[model samples]
Every structure is written in C-alpha cells, then in structure tokens.
Target: MPKLGYTAAQIRAAEAPLLAKGVPLMIRAAQALADHVTSVLPEPSASRVLVLAGAGDNGGDACWAASFLAEAGVQVNVVPVMGRLSPEPEAGARESGARILTEAKPVDAAQLVADADVIIDGMLGIGAGGTAAGGSPALRGTARDWALAVHAALTENPHPLVIAVDLPSGIDPDSGEVAEPEAVIPADLTVTFIGIKAGCLQGEGAKLAGKVWLEPIGASQHLLGVPPAVTVS
Candidate 1:
C-alpha cells in the first residue's frame, strides 16, 4: 500500500469526478461505516448510537449512517453539534427516516454522548480548511471544548467505541498536524475515503487514526491523469 497524507485540496479534487458520476460519497461512506459498526457491535440488535455530526460532509456521512442504523430498529441519534449539512447527503439521510437532533438538542447530544454505546465522530474532515479549516483560534477552541467533553465522558461514563469519519474533529488532514491535542478525539476505527495519507500512517496521527479503513468512494478517476508521486513496476 502507498504511504502518504492527502491534503484537503487533493481530497476535494478527487471528489470531482465521482460527484459528477453521481456517486454519493457521503452515502457510500456512511454505508461502509454502518456495515463495520454492525460487525463489531456487541449487540447490534438493540444498541444506542450517538453520531456527533459537524457542519461538513463528514457530518453528513454520520447523519446518513445513523439513519440506516435507526431504520434497522436500533436507537440512533444524529447530533448536529455544529454547523449545517450538505444538501443531497443530508436529504438522503432524512429519507432513511431517522430522528435527527438539530442544534436544538445540544443538551441531548451532550447527555447521550456520555451514555451511548457507540459514537460516530464526524466533526471534521480533510476539507478542514478555509475559514472553517486548520481552524482559527475560535474554531479550535470550540473543537477543544468538544474534545474535553468526550474525554470526560469516555473516562467517567461507559467509554463508548468511537468511529470517526475521515480525520478526528480537530486534526489537520493535509499536514496531519494537531493544534488542539487536548481536543483530539481519538478514533477506535477510522473509515477514510480514497487513498491513505501520510498523517494517518505515522506521527501522532497514527495513534489517532486507530484501525484505518479506505473506501474508494469512486474517486480514482480524478487521479487518472495526475502524475503520482511513485509508480511501482
């Protein structure tokens, strides 16, 4: 396997063709995540899932996956901890006919986050750049606070299994550098999209990544014409 860390730009560029082909990255990501969650769940039949969805595509994925789990008769809660969601992906998850807790339920997310069997950390992704990206002091602070809550819950409560979408909430995807280490919500399993990155393979990023999984999300086409850093014979 190739070892590398993908920048937010690269990941977004890769999504171009797939998005064009009508490939639903969020849906596919969610489905893959849901499948994995199902396999390892101590009791998939009757489990409570708490999805900490941010405002980005990562959050969208968690929302969709929670919807699937909810439909299966599992108790699922979609916590939009911050920001909003993408249109199509959010709509798809809504159609799955699950209960979504908007910003209105911040208290609920905080409570369920402490007592849930599983927590899907979809707070951030590679696209973590621009105004909302590496994170300004304010954004990082928000993420740091979120992390503190999770850490407290994990230590004091049931210590739920965490499955992160893409990178953890406060981590930098391109550089794999962490600003708010305290806010770093380490993943028990990370369902990543496209190819692997440098950060997830080494450094503090590795520990945070935990068990890494790659989903194509139909993004290879975008890399077809681009020159790769390495070419094996």
Candidate 2:
C-alpha cells in the first residue's frame, strides 16, 4: 500500500459511526496523547507540563490527558484559552490536581510556556476549519494571544518540547494555509488521530507539524472504504 492522507471531512465521516456507537474515542485519544507526552519526558514527576486548551473537542482531549499526567505525578497546568472549557475533562484535570489557569495574562502565558518542560498545543484541531459564520481559520481571541506567547517563548528559549494534540491551531487542515503564522506554534511532535491529514504533509503545514504520529483510536475499520484526499508519491 501507499502513504495516504485524508481531508478533514473524510476523517469526520469516519469518526461519525464510532461516535454514534459511543466508543469513547476521546478517552482513547487522551490516553495515547498522555502516553506520548510521558514517554518524551525524562522525569515525569519533576517536569512541568502546560496544556493550551481551547473550547473544542481537541481541548477536551488535552484536558483529559492533563488529568492522566497529573495522576501520574507530573505537574500539569492547563490554560483554557477560550475562557470556556470542556467541563467534564476540565473537572477531571482539576480532580487530578492539574491547575486550570483561566484568566492568565499574555505575559504570564508566555512565561508559563517558557517555564514548561513540555507544552501540549490543544488550542485547535481539524474541526476548527472555520467559525459558525464561515470566517478565516486564523487564531483569534485568547487562543491567538496564547499562540503568540508560545511562539515567542519557544523562539527565545527553544528548550520546552511542544506536542500538538492534532493539527497546529492556525493552519488550514485541507489547503495547508496559515492565515496567522505568528499565531501558530510549530510543533516538535503532533499526535494526530485517525488518519494523517493531507494538509499536514503539504507546504507550510509539513514544516509546522514536525513528526506526525497517527493514533488510530479504533477508526481504521470505519475509514477503510473512504478514499484519501491525497496520496504521497
């Protein structure tokens, strides 16, 4: 077989049936993400991990992973950039002792990024294609602020590792376009779910995404009949 890439729509289609069946895909993704983060850390108990969480399912995934990391004794801090949070996972994160920083200032957010041993970029995912009114895919509001902070901090120190939960927040998942390059934190590793996105392998996205790790989350069989949007030659 060949290396293949799927569009955001196709991936969503593949996920629909599983979600209907209530397969706990988010938990599975969270487990895989937490495992990957732990694997990269040299000392889990001593490390400071920051999760830049948005209001989407991607943010939920990060918050859930934060819970797992906190349970394992990693110092976990989550900034719900969109002000609102995914309540269930956020509750779990809090219960596991992860600090939920809801109103962090831009400078403080930057400092948090600088101080972290690892940063989980969960501010956006493929579902963040556009707004409800069909606007641009650029980062906005607190999410934009935090992304800029992460970019600046990383540029200065370059010490902390970044693990993007899915695709980087600002890049277009189908066209590989970035409306606000400054608002995107190029990942050191991206733990993508289901299939590899076509955009992640193309143009600026390839650069921003870094090493792409595909976590199936039990969606493979559902996607067997769906054709890829692009195929690597």
RMSD of each: 3.7, 1.9
The number of clashing residue pairs in each candidate reads 6, 0
Model 2's number of clashes is 0
Residues 1-233, candidate 2, lDDT per residue (tens digit)? Answer: 56577777778889999899988999999999999999999989999999999898999999999999999999998998989788899999999999998778677966887789999999888885533225366789888988888898888889889999878888888766788789999999999999987778776888999998999988967778788877876
- Candidate 1 residue-wise lDDT, 16-82, digit = tens: 7778878777778888888877777777667888777777777788878877786676677665666
Q: Candidate 1: misplaced stretches above 4 Å?
A: 87-97, 103-110, 130-144, 224-233
Instruction: Estimate the lDDT of model 1.
Output: 0.68
Worst 10 residues of 1 by lDDT: 130-139
- TM agreement with the true structure for every prediction: 0.82, 0.95
- For this target, which candidate reaches the highest TM-score against the unseen true structure? 2
lDDT per model vs. reference: 0.68, 0.87
